[model samples]
Target: MSQKRVLITGAAGFLGSHLCDKFVSEGYFVIGMDNFITGDSKNIAHLTGNSNFRFIEHDVTNYINIEGDLDYILHFASPASPIDYLKIPIQTLKVGSLGTHNCLGLARSKGARMLIASTSEVYGDPLVHPQTEDYYGNVNTIGPRGVYDEAKRFQEAITMAYHRFHGLETRIVRIFNTYGPRMRLNDGRVIPAFMGQALRGEDLTVFGDGSQTRSFCYVSDQVDGIYKLLLSDYTNPINIGNPHEISIKDFAEEIIQLTGTDQKVIYQDLPIDDPMQRQPDITRAKDILGWEPKVGRAEGMKKTFEYFKSLTEEELYKSEHKDFTNYHK
Candidate 1:
C-alpha cells in the first residue's frame, strides 16, 4: 500500500512541527511549509534527512504551489504567540484569512481532507466559563489583540463556507492553551516567560491580579486530539484541549515549584485585551473524537523545562521583545 500524503503549513512552528513529526512517524509523506516569520528552522531540523519528510520555504499568504496529490492538509500557518502576532499584525491577519483561503483552495483542488487550527482567543475575554462551541464569543474587534482573534474567526468562517458550498472535507480545531517542548524561551507567552525566568534564576513576572484562569493541554495530547479530529466526520468547529484550569498566579507558582527555582513572583501590567479566563469545554471532543488529555501538568512541565535547559546561554538571554516593522506585506 502507498503511504498517505499530508501537507502541513507553518510546519516549522511549535504546533506545526509537532504535527509534522506525528504524521511522518505514522508513515505519511509529510510536506512542511514555512516562511520562518516567527518559526525557527531548528524545530524541524531532526527530519532533515528523513525520506518521507520534505521541506518547502514558502509563505502561505502568497500563492501556494505544491506538486502531486495531497491526502490531507493541516493548515497550521500564522503567528500564534501573543508577542509574535502583535509584532507582525498584518501578516498574522493575512495568514489567517488569505493563507487559510489558499490552503482551502488547494485542498479543494486536490480532493483532500483539510483541518484548520483555530484558537481559544476567538472567545476573547470570554464571558462564558468553560467555553463551549455554541457560545458566541465576547470580542473587541478594534482592540490590539483583535488582529489575531479576528483573523482566526475569519478563518473559521471561510472554512465553514468551503465545507458547506464546495462540500469539502474540512475540520476546525479551536486549540486552547497548549504547552510542551519547542516553545521558545522568550515567546512572551506566560509559560515561556515564567519558565525562562525560572531557568535563568530571575523573578517570574505575573501580569494582572493573577486571577485570570487558563486550561493547558500538553502538546502530545493536543496532537492526538487533532489527529482524531482530522479522521472524524465532523465539519463544525470543535474544542480540543485539557479541561484542567488554573489561574495565572497559581500557574506561576506551579512553574516555580516545577523548576525548583527560588525566584519570587513579580507583578506587571496586564496587556490590553488579555483573556481573563480560558478553559475549553471538551464535551464535544470527548464524545466525537473520544479524546482527552492524558499528560498531567507536573509531567508536562518537567519535560518542557528540560528542553529549555538544553538551549545555549545566548538563546536563554535573547530578548523576545517584539521589534519589527509595522504592517508590512
Candidate 2:
C-alpha cells in the first residue's frame, strides 16, 4: 500500500506534537502546521530532521494551501488553555470558525478524512454528571469562558453539518482535561499551574473552595484514543478522557506529595464560568473504538512531574501569562 500523508494543525502544541510523532512512527508522511501564537517551536524541534515529518509555520485562520494529495486532516489548531483563550478570545473564535472551515474545505477537496479536536468544554458546566456525548451543555454565551466553550460548540455543529449535508468523512473527539510533558508551566490550567508552583516552592492555589473537580488523561493515552477515533468507521463524536475524577483540593494535595514539596494549599476565588464538575463518559469510545485510559493518575502525574522538574530555572520563573503581542495572522 502507498504511504498516507496527514496534515496536523497546532502541530507545535502539546497534543499536536504528540499526534505528529504518532503518525510519523506509523509510517505516514506527517505535515505539521502551527502559527506559533500559543505553540512553542521546541515542542516539535525533535522532528526537524525526520524524513516522515515536515513543518509549516502558518495560521489556520487564513486560507490553507497544501501541495499534494492529502489523506487526512486533524484540526487541532486552537488556544486550548484558559490563560490563552482569555488573552486572545477573538483569535480563538476565528480559529474554531474560520480555521475549521478552511480545513473542511481542504479535506473535501482532497477527499481526505477529517477529525476535529473538540473539548469537554462543549459540555460547559454541564448539568449531567460524567458528561456523555448526548448531553446538551449549559453554557453562558456571554460569560468569560464563553469564547472557548462556544467556539468548540460551533466547531462541533459545523463539523456535523458538513458530515450530513456534504457527506464528508468527519470525526470529533471531546477531549477532557489532559496533562503531560510540554504543557506550558505558566498556563492557567490546574495541572501545569500546580506543578509549576510546586517546583518553585510556592503554595498551590485552589480556586472556588477547591470543590471543583477535573479528570485528567495523560497525553500519550489521549493521543492513542484520538488516533483510534480518526481511523474508526464511526463519524460521530466520542469522548476521549480518563473518567478518573478528583477534586481540585485533593488534587493539590496529590501534587504536593508527588513533588515532595513543603508548600501548603491556598484557596482563591474561582474564575467566572469555571466548571464545577468535569468528567467524560467514555462508554462510546470503549464500545466503538475499544479504547480506554490505561495510565493511572499516580503513575501519569509522576512522569509529568519529572518533565517539569527537568525545566531550567528561567522556564520555571517565566511570567504567569505569556506575552502574545508579537503574534499576528
Candidate 3:
C-alpha cells in the first residue's frame, strides 16, 4: 500500500512535533509546516534526516498551496500558550480563524480528511466540573484570554460549518493541558514554568493561591488520541485529556519533589480569566476512540524532568529568567 501524505501545521510545536513523529513512524509521508511564532525548528530537528519527513516554513494564516494527493491535514497551528497568544493576540485570532479556514479549503481541494487541534480553553472558566463536550462554555469574549478562548471557539464553529455546508471530512480534538519533552521552556504554561524554575533553583510561582486544578495529559497519549480522531469517522469535537485532577499547589509541590530543588512555592496574583479548574470529560473519547492517557502524573513528570535535566545549565537558566525579565522591568 502507498503511504498517506500527512501535512501537519504548527509542526514544530510541542504537540505538532510529536504528531509528526508518530505519523512518520507509522509509514506516512509527513510534511510539517510552521512559522515559528511560538514553535521552533529545534523541536522537529530530530526528524530532519528522515526520508519520510519534510519541513516547510509557512504561516497557516497565509495561503497554503500544496501539490499531490494529500491524504490528511492536521491543523495544529496556533499561539497556544498564554504568554505566546497574549504577546501576539491578533496573530492568535488569525491562526484560529483564517488558518483553520485555509486548512479546510486545502482539505476540500485535495479531498483529504483534516483534524483541527482545538483546546480546552474553549471551555473558558467552566461552570461545570469535569467538562464534557456537550457543555456550553462560559467564555469571556473580551477578557485578556478571550483572544485564545474565543478564537478556538470560532475555529470549531467554522470547522463544523465546513463539514456541514461543504461536505468536507473534518475531525476536531479539544486538547487539554498536555506536557512532555520538546515543550518550549518559556511558553508560560504551568508545567514548563514550574520545571524551568525548579531546574534553576528558583521559587515556583503558583498563581491564585494555588487552589486552581487542572488535568495534565502526557504528549504521547495526546498524539494517540489525535491520530485516532483523525482516522475515525466522528465529525464532532471530542475532549482528549486525562480525567485526573490536581491542585496547582500540589502540582508545584510534586515538581519540587521530582527535581529535588530547595525552591519554595510562591503565590502570585492569578492572571485575568484564568480557569479555576479544568478536567476533561473523556467519556466520549474513551467510548468512541478507545483511548485514555496511559501515563500517570508522577511517571509523566519523571520523564519530563529528565528531559529538562538534559538541557545545558545556560539553557535552563535562560528559560527560568526569560519570563521574569519583563516583569522586573
Residue 30 error, candidate 1, Å: 0.3
Query: Cα deviation of 301 in candidate 2 (Å)?
Result: 0.6
Q: lDDT per residue, candidate 1, 1-329, as tens digits?
A: 87899999999999999999999989999999998888889999999999999999998998888999899999999888888888888999999999999999999999999999999989999999989999879999999999999999999999999999999999999999899999887787888889889989999999998999989899999999999999999988999999989999999999998888899998989999999999999999989888999999889988988898898999899877655664477
Would you give me the overall lDDT of model 1? 0.92
Over 4 Å off, model 2:
326-329
Greater-TM-score candidate between 1 and 2:
2
Per-residue alpha-carbon lDDT of candidate 3 for residues 1-329, written as tens digits (9 for 90 to 100) = 88889999999988999999999989999999998777778899989889999899998888999978899999999878888778777888988999998999999999999898899999999999989999889999999999999999999999999999999999999999999998878678999889888887789999989999999999989999998999899999999999999999998988898988888889989999999999999999999999989999889889999999999877776642223223111
> What is candidate 1's TM-score against the reference?
0.98
Error of 1 at 65 (Å): 0.8
Model 2 RMSD in Å is 1.1
- lDDT of the candidates, in the order given: 0.92, 0.94, 0.89
**For model 3, the run of ten residues with the poorest summed lDDT:** 320-329
Clashing pairs in 3: none
| Model 3 lDDT at residue 235 | 95
**Best of the candidates, lDDT:** 2
Candidate 2 lDDT over 143-259, as tens digits, reads: 999999999999999999999999999999999999899999878888999999999889999988999999999999999999999999999899999999999999999999898
